[model samples]
Target chain A: MSGQTLYDKIWQSHLVSGDDEAALIYIDRHIIHEVTSAQAFEGIELAGRSIWRSDSILATPDHQVPTTEREKGKAGFVDKLALLQVTTLDDNCDKNNIVQFKLNDQRQGIVHVVGPEQGASLPGMTIVCGDSHSSTHGAFAALAQGIGTSEVEHVLASQCLQQQKCKNLRVLVNGCLPLGITAKDLILYIIGKLGTAGGTGYAIEYAGEAIENLSMEGRLTVCNMTIEAGARSGLIAYDQVTENYLHGRPYAPKGAMWDSAIQYWRTLVSDADAVFDKELIIDAKDILPQVTWGTKPDQVVAVTSQVPEISSAKDAVQQADWQKALSYMSLNSGTAISSLSLDQVFIGSCTNGRIEDIREVAKVVKGKKVASTIKRAMVVPGSGLVKQQAEAEGLDKIIMAAGLEWRFAGCSMCNAMNPDSLASGERCASTSNRNFEGRQGQGGRTHLVSPAMAAAAAIAGHFVDIRQVELAQLEGIH
Target chain B: MAAFVAHQGWVAPMDRSNVDTDAMMPKQYLKCIFKSGYGDWAFDDWRYLDAGDVDVDVSTRRKNPDFELNKTIYQGASILLSRENFGCGSSREHAVWGIRDMGFKVVIATSFADIFYNNCFNNGILALTLKPEQIERLFELSGDKAMSLTVNLQEKRVTLANGEFYSFELEENRRFKMLNGLDNVATTLLKKQAIQDFEKQHKQTHPYYFTPLR
Candidate 1:
């Protein structure tokens, strides 16, 4: 028998029965958000079926809730449809007796952030969410996959998903991480090497010394973008970092149970002789802080590099993609990336909206003023708790002092389903995932960056090498 | 769910790779809470000249003349022949909903993102891939003109109007679901005993999963 990878071990433990053709897998957690969920709830209601394992479900609204005026709950919405969707989730969760962090609840936040914070997603378990970023919890060595709304309903009705096995693809990012480089840059670099579909039909395990050295929050940020590589899911083995993060989280096991859980989690690492279907080793030294200059996440360039020229593309087909991106983003080919002026700066999303990300932003712009060329910049925390912690540490004050709007929690401008959206043709430096066309709002160009990069962009009004800025600030203080 | 035994329709070539769900049904239209109304918003950003939201009626939006879907030749096309990573970002079934609502029963791509591919069969749409050369050939055949293709799920072949055909492989489980219109929910319900058995054993083995919140 071959030694199983972390994913295989979790899969075996969750296998209800059957083969890879149609294996019945027991679902340990289901995280639900509003936009993808309303139809699922409707399916459950129309079918006249109740939740099979309601205890396994965690419900929250992220996509459509207004990040501002959230204290008023459904009444906070200036958009009636948005209000209806947010309240509908509340009614469904209440009616089903499922635990939900309601809009006004302090515990509420992005489903991905809340999952790990509350420890609802634990090691050696199978986690599914309707939103794609659910891979964030895989930082805990869980087999986490993002599901569509239909699968959401199926999980609600059965607590079991009929799944086929995914092949394993291990990505080893070794070597020391350069200063001022973040997990966002690391993952973006990996995605650049592996095109949007490079990890298709496989589950990716992120390993190597660099991955093993990341903080739980940093690891979560990396895993959250797994789907962008078209991977089924992403996983990282449980280690002391995982234990420290989950130790006393609300839903984590307690007392003797904690010891028991740790024993099992200690087994989550891949055995020495274990083999993967495919493997790619990335040296972290080759990575630089990334800024996506195009419509796709894979069309990324280093902050100091020029916007990629169409001729630089590998083939005519690639040039075609580059042409579309260049046209849509209204950028001239071969222009310096740092020369592009920004219309706005947004620092939030499941990927970069964590508390540590807020701290990074505070460090970058703690006393700096927003550049006169920048029209607007804002910071929306991941969860109400994140917002509260930033306020406690006075990070929010520093960010607000730098002239960025400090907003409440929700997906906010990430998807811009609510009132927080970019105007037509507005360019932005954003800490959110996905640089897809019209992702923030129609015709709103977005350059994906790290929190510090976005904060620096807010002050500089253009992309700059974050390392140089940090070094300058350090020297000035000295 | 409807059985997808065979589908024949005008093939509309999307002509781009990495077309995401967000672009298919932009976030503005995602709050509608129902699946049926997303057709007009399938490629909302590109299909229209004016921006749309759930508040503004799509009927009032000006159609972009340059867009493929708005072009007269591809009207009522039900098969989408496109390129690599056809559905890449987000787990929004609304993308599949928008495509289905737009009347596309089959999407031929070089590859598809996993979640979007799964969402397709669940909603009675067939998302399949062909060899690179085959996709290239299809694009060449259909360039700047509306072409018709017959997607036969039963035989796993896509037949062109010129009688050329490409055979693709699909997992038997997914193929069974699409051909029979058996939604996994109804099918999984039949395995209630197995789920219960698994739960019983799972609780005994992994006691932490069932413990009360502290």
Candidate 2:
């Protein structure tokens, strides 16, 4: 018999039943957030359908709630509304018996960040959320993706999900990354080359020498940006790195069951000689620390490269787009990227706001002070645990002493769901993905870069290459 | 509603790929919870340096503008032209809100990311796709003037008022929804009676008996 790819094996195993058009796939885990779940709960009430298998469903309030006000209990009715949404979810879960991590609960943060920390996100599980970046969970070697509010309602009513099988694409990144290039750079380079839509209609399996060498945190960063490239999910084949990350976690199996879990996880890798519908090969040597120059993630150039000239584009539409991007950014073509100044800097999100990202930024900003000209710079960790870890290492003090704001954990400024945002027309060097017009705030200009790059830019008050600063720290670290 | 076919004018230049929903409509205005009037705030930050404040005059902003939309090559565009894989991040319908609110009737690109494209069709926004060469030609002709691009929803054809035509593909369900302005929720609600009947029948057979888990 021919060997089956991990995608085929997991997908086939999850299939409850199927016909030609669609299949009912049993979902292993369901995560809910405030922004999309409110309406879903309303739909459930309207439909008068009680939630079945509430134990498998998990709820949290992340998107709309303010991370800063998290400590003050619930602030006012709006915050209370968000709290009420969580309460309603908890109440519904309580009435039907579903598990949730409330705001005051020990495990509370962004849904994606908290899911993994609590060991709720396991391999071979099919996870779904109402938010798009739920693809971030696929790093655990699961087939995870997002759904609409209506679909969320369906999943709540029935534990099963109706899904179409996705085509598998094996993206092979060979060779080792050059010094100073992280997984953020690798994925950014891929998105830039692929033009964002490169992975449509496919679930990408990141393989080869480079991916296997990546740490768990690094794999999460790559998987987080898969959606930015228009792929449903991106995953690495689990190995010793995966086992080590999950070994002591709360929800991971213990003792003899742990050995069995590892045995099953070891089998989660793509079978040798397994066929994939599509294949893409990228060389790690070719990638560099990247930054978004335009309104999109794919419209990026190397840190050393100049903003692309509109006149140089062969297509008139592309030329016009180039001109528009230049106009909005208030940047002229041929200007060196290093010459650009920044008003603000933000480093946090599901994308690069984990503990490792905080540590990396702290190493660069420790001895350095943020430039006086820069108006604001903040480092929001991905979760409470990440914040605690950074503080334990004195990384928070380093960030604060350098004159940057050390914020409470949440998806701050990544999306303007919270008070943290750029004033209109304010240009910022952000570690978060996407630089579309007004993404950070109305008329806010965003330049996407890695966390370390954002730290370097914050210190210089302009876009600067992190490699220019010699750091004895993070040299021998993974 | 009349299924009138409008003539396609010149194809304006395409925007960069992966323009997210948040960039289309900043989260500040999402507080309203209603979909209407969001068009004014569609690219509020990009349209003005401050929200609700347009520093440069509208005509001058349209003329001597530093804004992306006012650039000479893409002036007075009815149809927006873009590269492949447009609208990639965040499933916020605001991305479509911004696109439609900005007075763009149609968006032509090589491809569109799933959610944003669906949101566009659901809100009466047309996504016209074509080969790269054809899109390139539209941009060449649009050069710094007001050009008319006609979109015929019934025929599913995009025509430049000057007489170039292109055909694109869309799923049948999406086509029906776009033409009628029906979303999944609205469609589901249409089957309310059938759903109610099914529930009633199921309830009758199952019989309500509660046994608390110990």
Candidate 3:
């Protein structure tokens, strides 16, 4: 038999029983949030079943939690529908004996962001969540994926999930990244090349020189968008970078246990001769800051390129899709992306709302002012800890000084679960994932870009190549 | 849970490709804890000229006369004839809920996004895949007319109005679950003993992974 890929090693280790076609995989961590999980808890409760291992599950109310008016407590929710979902989750967590990070708690944040920061996600373990973005946890080399509500109920009742084994696909991004390119740009570029369905039916492992060089937070950004590429899970082999990031975190192992865990993690890599079902090689030097021109993540192009014309599409379907996307975005064909004006700027989501992302944006717009023509601009941290760390580093001050609204952490404006959404016919340069039509709000258009690029757009009142923007001199800043 | 052994409904053609869950049920509507009532807001942005709200009566709302679903011929259609990548983006089961509640029991497409397809099966909605050519043919056949199609899960076949039939495949376990109106938890319970044994061994070997309730 051939040597096994890292995905195979993790899958086999987590396999409880049955053949490769379908088996019960033990879940180490189960993360739940307000959006997709209410019905799951209700399902089990109605069936007279209880959470099998409440301790293994982490609950938080993100998605619909307002990013403003924190002092108002639960009553702070302006929408009745938002209040109901958030309160439902609270009731479920309390009744099930699961510890939850309440809205007022310091730990409360986006499920995907808080999981790793709290050390609940670790290498060689299996993780599942009701949210698709749970693939974010796979950055730690864990076997992670998103599940439907039915599967959520299954895991809550048994702490295990029945799943079919997926084929392995390895994406090796080699060479050094050029300046101004972020992991967000890299992922968007890859998804653009490999259509949204490219990673379907497979578990993709990102490897090579470029992936290895990424910081842990950058790795999280890459893995977080794996779902948009249509991958059930995306993984990076555990190494020093992974281990160092996990050390001493809240729920990470300690002392002898930590040593033992590291010892086991060392074995999590693929064997030298391991074979993948498919392998794709991407040159990092060829990549640039990317922006999605269409509703889907895969419909992306480098920031410097113009909107592609319908006649240039390879097929009839593509031509029609291009026309539709252009009509919805209200952009002219062949016009440079940099020429597109923006009405709003959003620099936060599970995709790019980590401390590093905020720091990068702050570095870009420190002494600058947001364009007077830009209607709205906001920077939301990923988690409460990230928010606090940004404040401690004075990143918030720099962002606020640039005239961008500094908001609390959540999945703000990413999918517009809160009040931070764009109005009808508005166009925005966002740091969030998924620029699907009306994703930010009804009839609102979105362009996906990096935090730095988004910040640059906020200042210019239009999309601009971040590399061309001169950083404000720190010495001149008050 | 309800069995979906066979469904016969008039077809409604959604000519667009990559009809994502967000478009099916916008993010704003996901706020409600209730699974029902999403039907009224399904495709709300495109369904109505005016912004839609739950409390507003859909009948009185300014329906988009140009939208496919509002067309006179497709008024009560139950099977959605769509293009490739139907139900892409997001793992929200609420999207499936809205589709089902909107009277669509079947979705015929060339392919489907992974999570959305699974959610369809769980919700008793048959998401059948056909070859691209066959899907194109179906779309051609659906043009300018409300065509009645039959999806028989028992036989794993989709019969066209002209007496043509195409076979589809589903996993045996999934098929069993659908036929018996069983949810995943109910089926997994049968393997409870094996799961319990595994957990016992796992907790001991990986004690740090488990955080028992205090």
**Candidate maximizing lDDT:** 1
DockQ of 2: 0.19
Which is better, 1 or 3, measured by DockQ? 1
Q: Assess the local accuracy of residue A107 in candidate 2 as a C-alpha lDDT between 0 and 100.
A: 61
Instruction: Sort every candidate by DockQ, greatest first.
Output: 1, 3, 2
User: Model 1 - which docking category?
Assistant: medium
lDDT of 1 by residue, A412-437 (tens): 88988888888889999998889999
lDDT of 2 by residue, B119-188 (tens): 5665567786788788767666665565677777777777776677787776555566567655444444
| True-vs-predicted CA distance for residue A81, candidate 1, Å | 0.4
TM-score of chain A for the candidates in order shown: 0.97, 0.95, 0.98
Candidate 2's fnat? 0.28
Query: What's model 2's lDDT at B139?
Result: 64
- The CAPRI classification for model 2 reads as incorrect
Error of 2 at B136 (Å): 8.0
Evaluate every candidate with DockQ and list the scores: 0.77, 0.19, 0.66
What TM-score does each of the candidates earn?
A: 0.98, 0.80, 0.98
Per-residue lDDT tens digits of candidate 2, residues A265-341? 78888889888888889999988788888877878988998998787775765676677777878888888999999
Q: What's the C-alpha lDDT at position A229 in model 2? A: 76
- The residue-level lDDT of candidate 1 at B180 comes to 93
